[model samples]
Target: MSRTVAWTPEATETFDIIVELIETKWGFASAQKFVRTANQTILTLASHPEMFVTVKGQTIRRAFITKQTSLFYEITEQQIILLYFWDNRQEPIL
Candidate 1:
């Protein structure tokens, strides 16, 4: 069964910043495409939450790269939580 998804305040802020930056650097279409791909990744994770391996015994999920950014998330029985939107050039937080 599909699980519910939720974004923490930090996650929401991170996503907004990424979208704004993408729009400023590229264009609305590019930002829109990024958002669409990110959403699809979340849905895919929710449907098959087990696809991600645990990190420090926590379910830390990483999205396949599209362009320069990567989407990271965490999943639990009650919630599929977005952890961060990371730029692939930089090291992951955790």
Candidate 2:
């Protein structure tokens, strides 16, 4: 069965910021492409939530939507919560 996927407020904000930057730096077409790919990945995750690798000790998982972008999420009995949309190029904060 397919699970439900929802984004946390922070993840939504990250997505908006990234999309806007992509639109400005590249074009609407590029931004649209990114959105489409990301959405499809989310939808796909619903049915195959364990398809991605775990980030570490946490139950949270990381799915690479693109070479530079990743979708961080956690799954529960209730729903799949998207934690963040991360830019992998940047060094992770400790």
Candidate 3:
């Protein structure tokens, strides 16, 4: 069976920010495209959770949403819990 996908609050907020940025920078159509692409990519995890290599740790995996962003998630037996949505274009907050 395919695992369910759940987005954390942080991930949802990050997604909102990116979509808003795209809408403001490009247009609603671009933002819709971005969301559709991202959702399709995210769904790929349900059937193949191990597609992406673990980046942050042994349990966490990342899947690219766009050229500049990726979604980080952890896989359990029944679901994939989305942890964060990272935007690569921004400066590292260090």
Candidate 4:
């Protein structure tokens, strides 16, 4: 069975920040596209939780696509919480 996914408040806040940043740097359409790609990536994780590796005993995963930003997330028993989005041009914080 597929695992359920729920966003933490922190995840929601990060999503909002990403949307705002995309809108500011690109456009509304680009922000919408990012949201669509993010949702698809999260669902992919839910369907294949094993694809993620553990970090400090937590299941932390990243989705990377060339010419696009990467998404960081953590998987728990009850939820897939997004941590942050990192532009490919910058280094990730962890």
Best by lDDT: 2
lDDT of 3 at 83: 87
TM-score per prediction, in order, is: 0.83, 0.94, 0.91, 0.73
Candidate 1's C-alpha lDDT? 0.79
Q: Write the per-residue lDDT of candidate 2 for residues 19-85, one digit (tens) a residue.
A: 8988999999999999999999999999999899887677989999999899999999868899889
Alpha-carbon lDDT of model 3:
0.88
| lDDT, residue 12, candidate 1 | 84
* Candidate number with greatest TM-score: 2
Can you rank all candidates by lDDT, best first? 2, 3, 1, 4
- Name the TM-score of candidate 2: 0.94
Residue-level lDDT tens digits of model 4 in 64-93 = 522667766776776666666667677656
Q: After superposition on all CA atoms, how large is the RMSD of candidate 4? A: 2.7
Model 1 spans > 4 angstroms off? 55-58, 65-67
lDDT of each: 0.79, 0.90, 0.88, 0.72
Q: What is the C-alpha RMSD of each candidate to the true structure, in Å?
A: 1.9, 1.1, 1.8, 2.7
Decide which is better by lDDT, 1 or 3. 3
lDDT of 3 by residue, 1-94 (tens): 6899998999899999999999999999999999999899888998899999887566888888888888889999999999888888877432
